[model samples]
Target: MKYRFVIILLSILILSSCEFSQKRYKPDWDKWKNYKWILNKNVRNNINSGFTLYKKNANFNLIRYNENNQLVIWEFKHHNYVSIDSINFFENIDLSNFILYPGQTFNKEDILETSVRINSDLDIDLHLNLNSDSKIYEYINKDKVKGIIGKVSQMSLSDETGYHQVLFDFPIRSYNVATLFFKRDDSFFILILFPDDGLVKDKLKDLNLPELNE
Candidate 1:
């Protein structure tokens, strides 16, 4: 009788928690996905303005207009990095040759090499396992991959001097990923998933995996 009562209480608690979470986030997923944003005034004025990207099965489209007002859409396959630009120009140099493992210690050269193409040659530092733990990987449930870590800069293209700010997150390693674009001060900023150490890197070729659409 005691064990049965405990199970009933636990079941009620789990159901209540689920109900609370759903009410808290009352998310309109469809509206968030398909809403055509008008973008800000600064974004409209740039030469790269009127650009839009829509993701498809296994690829994405980079859509823009030519001088004639005709649409030019370039479809690029979503694949892993072939070289340094795939990561960041700065992080690319050393990464091309070096093989990184989980829980490994990073050195001075690692810092220097990773900061090369970021923020106009500005140097970046890494703090292992304390402030920003590189060894600990986060699994972002939405994208179904290991979490990301590193500093991302969003800059304006019209005025080279204008930029928004830098965001830092960790372990530069997984697979399932998503990249979102935002325009600030007439510059474009992209939020991309950085791989964490896991089965993702090992099984990247399994391209037909399901997305979190449900």
Candidate 2:
């Protein structure tokens, strides 16, 4: 018996991949947690004719709004594969790095990629690592950090001009980070920060994290 048909074809390919992942995703425990979206209308007229972020002092809220293949199928059901989902920042975030909230960080992996080249057509660190639930931090750089290579910008509002942000600070080094990217009608809107330790850089130079409101 030639290895008995390779052990019955690897046990029918692991039971047909667990019966096609329990029939094309089944664990919709109300999509776990943190969700509430409704933009449609070309993503609410492209964030309502774009460019209007002057909030300056925190209250950042994007609350896990997915749509990059439904956050890659909700990271295949994240928030609790073994527990981890506590970002809590949408109710007067009094200060810190100002505002760069979204989520995803591992504390460090020695990333230093900054040549600035992300004007659209999504890649966003491969969909922000399929929306990580690792939850290392998200207040903009500092402590046991080694992650700051992210760069992307193309928050276009149709032939844009004026408001364009792609924040970063590389002055003699203090390990701080901030990144933002937005796009609609094709899905993509990202905000990330978690490499801080630069002591809120003079209140993030008087902040401006507000965006999206129509």
Candidate 3:
């Protein structure tokens, strides 16, 4: 009987340690890879679908369910030697339930507001959001270039295509974008981008609209 008690205690300790070492953020990258493509038929059903040219300095392509929906932007560089990064934003949503890292939490609503404010304050010409099936998608394109700004003379940088484009640059901004969202049963999935890339940002944005802000 004493030996049985010792074995049970050892088992409990092993399980506890294993649980502690496990990763809290479960990742699912493939969920949205295929979803990123926009079928030509999607554009036909949504007439708001089209790419916009902004003063030859930037390009934006989008599809919308309505005019008031929040915009989603995806931008990147196309140079052979240069690579771009992506960011994803949400409007009027409670994103705290979604885990990004161990003991990390963020509000989806705040992210959207910040992006809106930054682009608007910079006079970067914020695009319109189109809503459908409850989701809104927006795509943005910019000159592949880099610059500097802010009070400390903070260095600003971007690719020739105007996107930060790397995953490493985002930790400072407090984002660990996991584009894979589990399906209804946590089996299949959906891809969500904090900052989307131009290659598929527009394509994904052209997908079915998500539910609206309540």
54-144 in candidate 2: lDDT tens per residue? 1111112221221211111112111121111111112111122212222111112322211111231112122121011122234332221
Candidate that scores best on lDDT: 3
Relative to the true structure, how large is the alpha-carbon lDDT of every model? 0.25, 0.25, 0.27
lDDT of 2 at 4: 100
* lDDT tens per residue, model 1, 1-214: 9999999999999987665443221212232222122222332233232333222211111212122111112122332221112222122111222222211111123211111111221112211111221222332233322223333221111112222112222233222333222222322223333232323333222222233221
Question: Candidate 3 residues 1-214, lDDT tens each?
Answer: 9999999999999986666444222223232223223223544443332222121112222223233221222222122222212323223332222222223122233432211111211112111111111233332222321111111101112223333211111223332222221112212222233322323333434444331101
Instruction: Point out where model 2 deviates above 4 Å.
Output: 10-16, 19-214
Q: What's the true lDDT of residue 26 in model 2?
A: 21
- Cα error, residue 24 of model 1, in Å, equals 20
Candidate 1's clash total is 8
- TM-score to native of every candidate shown: 0.19, 0.21, 0.23
Q: What CA root-mean-square deviation does each model show from the true structure?
A: 19.3, 17.7, 18.9
